[model samples]
Target: MQALEERDYFTDYEILKDPYAFFEAVRSHGPVYQPPGRDYLIVTGFAETLEVLKNSADFSAIIGVQGASAPLPFEPSGSDISEQVEAHRDRILGGDLLVNYDDDLHTKTRALLNRLFTPSRLKANERFIDEYSDEIARQMIARGGCELMRDVATPFVTLVIADLLGVPADDRQHFMNVIDAAPPPGSLNTEENDFRGENHPLTVMGGFFARYILERRANPREDILNEFAHSTYPDGSVPELEELVKMAAFLFGAGQDTSAKLLGNSIRYITDQPGLQDQLRADPSLIPQLLEEVLRLEGSTKQTARLARRDTRIGDRAVPAGTKILVALSAANRDGERWEEPNAFALNRPKIKEHLAFGRGKHVCAGAPLARVEVRIILEKFLAYTSNIDLDEAKHGPRGNRDLNYDPSFIVRGLTELHVKFTPAEGVDLSQASSQAETAQ
Candidate 1:
């Protein structure tokens, strides 16, 4: 077993492409070690990963080299660079949003978000999620087979968020197009090409959402946007129009891609393993546990980066102030030290809930509960409407590179395309399943 310091981090494209091997390598090493180039401390063990996430005082998310000017990949040139970067950073970190802030600011924002995502509210939206999921499932069943990622997951989550935000039906297509144009992580080479194409969707969506907030301010509607428009600070002053727009952009941008990945990856996993699908079909009540297991085995997010605020020790490894730390959540979930069988997909795993799929600590995902609901709805609808689902083995690509490129993103993990076939449940009604089972009992 080699120490983490001995292993190559960046050049190992295979690590990014298929992280299961990387997870094994990390487990063999100690919990934490600085990768080559000394760019960041990579924490792979579950305990250490949790420690870094929970300890905000010792670590800060303020992107800088030793708290100095951090060299960003997207930094603009000329005199406008500083202003542009500052503006972007402010939009990302200055707000009381959970992702950007720590300590008191995170607490306040989390509290506000908690109120919006309460059990009652989630229950209320159950029917809405079910309706949308059923519609998508019906379409897939009708088609006999389809590309799961683009055709189903993408549109399903996009519309769900749009509907929840009360985006006008007429503008949904335009909204989706704008979102699709936005740069995804791991596509830095294509970033310039995308920027040259049209007004960046981030800017357009920000402007449109800001205008919507203003309209809601004049005539409040019963929607999330209206609530956001009217939401205020502790002093009772509403967030500025720009802030509201940024918030909307954050919600849409954050929610759309991640959820799509979750749906796509989970579906792929189930289809590839018929036994798991059969187990799920046998006991629908185990959906929650099964979902957790799937997320742990094939989570969307792989790693997150943080900056060391002070000279800190992570699992006996010394990290200097301003050092960047990459917490590999996906690796942590598969740490051999933590789980009895770390790599295998076990629907019955007792500790499935312990996975870091939604992350941990102050910056944990705000949309986790909603995402879980969406996934559950889709799975239920899929099982109910389809008799048998399987990956098209003929369509499977070579041994090394699969047909679907797992988006080359360290922050998120998911299939680029998932091809599967299913036998549609015709003549057999879903409502009849319960009656037949009862009769058997």
Candidate 2:
């Protein structure tokens, strides 16, 4: 291969398949190195990435989703362009997103989200997740083979989060129908002139949430949606209807996409190593450790964008206000300086949770607990239901020359689809599992 540094990380499609090598090529220049000819900075250093994620004051998330692909609405005015950003926030793509808000607004809007992902809430939702995972597992077993992403992960994740948030059972099919037709979360290209804005899943799902929020406010119910509808900020002021809808929709979209991708990543790695696969099947307790390693090695999110809110120094490089910075989480996670064998997947890596995959500080993925439980429970189910799992050789081709395709997105890194074949475990009783589920209820 030619010098990885010579490739344009943004526009080059082939580089997306394996950007880590490119990241390493850049890291050799220093973690905080600016690519030659690029107008923005990309942070690959472990510590520097955390520094950017932690100090939200100096790094604005206004470009959090769009990244350097979409330009700012207005030019930087001075040493600190905070006011200039606010003045044109409405015109900036993704500026209104919960992930894009900064400082006080971010803190406040994020506060209402606590009720959704709390330990108590997640615990209460576990029984449903368990049943759903088992339900999907049984289906996979009956089929003997499956398209993992479409047939399994996507629907499995979507329904699980919707159920947790108290979307009425009758409305779930409608939710799926709407979501099935829209762009995968984190796949939007706002830079396109003719982008189909109507096709965003959030726009349709937000309407359903709007109706539910209104109904809940008029007659507070005993469900999670009631709590969600009535959640307030630190000052106890109620957020507007629009804000509540965005929060709920954002939570559902973000959680579903990342969790499903994590599941896909987990299965691919586990099955790729037969020893690791056998270890997981024999000792289910190691699933959690496997998850942590998976998140560190092949996280669902590749990178998130940050705008320098003021002139600041990241390591040796000076980042000016308005300069867009791509917080290369994948690169930071695999920084050789931080890990002994950075590219290798080591299940027992020390301080495993320290990776910047879910980001850090206030903007850390709020739905993370739910995501963990979702991926974990489903993985446990897959193992329980199958005697052995193998990549469908016909679909992906022979081991060395596989044809698995990653989603062509600028932000998230995930498979476009995964086809797997499994042998049903002998003596595993799905009927008994269903009976136990009914008995518990």
Candidate 3:
């Protein structure tokens, strides 16, 4: 096993495009290593990741990398670009959004956010998810296939979140546009930099959603936006308008991309494993477990970063305070020491529940329950209505950057596109499609 010295750990574009080999390399190496530049520590083992995430007291999420300065391929250069970007990040982080905070603030924000995404609410979204997925699957199968990521996963996840937040129908496209404008880690260029400067998606979406909340307060509606309009802070004071918008924006941004990736990856996995698809089709009840298995196998968020708040030792390596430590969740899920046959894709793996794909500890994803519901609903509806799914290997080869491929940002991991072909199920009646649609409409 080659040891990964501190100099060679940050994901290169080639490695990022196809990370399986890189993950294997990291696993063979010790869990902790300092990559080149001595700027960060990479934690690749399952137990090590869990240790770092669980011990948040010694780690901080505030690594001062956000917006343009957030590890993009194109460097931002102005006399004060770093300072400007840092200021913007601080402002956004200082708001009541859950991901930006730690300690007491994170706890409070998470508690309030948790209430909105309770099991009952997530379960209720199932009907909507099913209908949306059915509509997408119908269109895709009719065309003999489609790019699953763009055609099905992205739009379906986006609209479901829009509905949940009461985003007006007309503005959903605008919402997507803003999100697209935001700079992900390695995807940026000069054009992207200009876009980020002019229309930072988070800021724009935050403002847009805040206005909606203001309107909801004036004439209350039966939507989560209304709930946000009325939600009080722990101090019994209403959250500020900006805070409300930021929270909704966070949910909208985080929810759609990750879920879309998971859904697309699940479809890809099923197509890749013909036997597994048969198993799922034969026993539809296994759809839920299969989703869990898919999450473990091809997680949407492959890595997470934490800054050492104080000097700490991880697996005998000394991490200095202020050093960025990245935990590769994908590597952790495949850690051989933790599970029997860790690299194999087993839909019935009993230890699937222990995977940190949704993360763990105080900052564990609050939207996981909702995300699971979305995946299950889509898989169930898809299998029931479609058959003979096959990958379109020739036309659109894998979509992420071949070198520093798809999982550009450590914050979220997913393929840029998944193209596949499929045949509609035999004798599967679409006559009742309208009625089925009404459930989500």
Q: Give the residue spans of candidate 3 off by over 4 A.
A: 1-11, 64-97, 180-196, 396-407, 431-441
List the candidate 2 regions with Cα displacement exceeding 4 Å.
1-3, 185-196, 430-441
| Candidate achieving the largest TM-score | 2
Residues 132-235, candidate 3, lDDT per residue (tens digit)? 77776665666677777766776777888887667888798777666654655334243442213446666678778878988998999888878878988687
Q: Tell me, what's the RMSD of every candidate? A: 7.0, 3.1, 5.7
For residues 116-224, what per-residue lDDT tens digits would candidate 1 score against the true structure? Answer: 5778777877777887677667667666888787677777777777777777766767777766655454432334223223465556677778888889989999887
Ordered by TM-score, highest first, the candidates read 2, 3, 1
Clashing pairs in 3: 6-34, 6-35, 6-36, 7-36, 13-403, 13-404, 14-403, 14-404, 17-405
Name the better of 2 and 3 by TM-score: 2
Candidate 3's displacement at residue 212, Å, is 0.8
Ordering by lDDT: 2, 3, 1
Flag the better candidate by lDDT, 1 or 3: 3
lDDT of 2 by residue, 129-241 (tens): 99878877876776788888887887888888887899887777777666655555445443331112655667778889999999999999999999989888899898999
Please report, in order, the local distance difference test score of every candidate based on alpha carbons.
0.68, 0.82, 0.68
Candidate 3 minimal-lDDT segment of 10 residues: 64-73
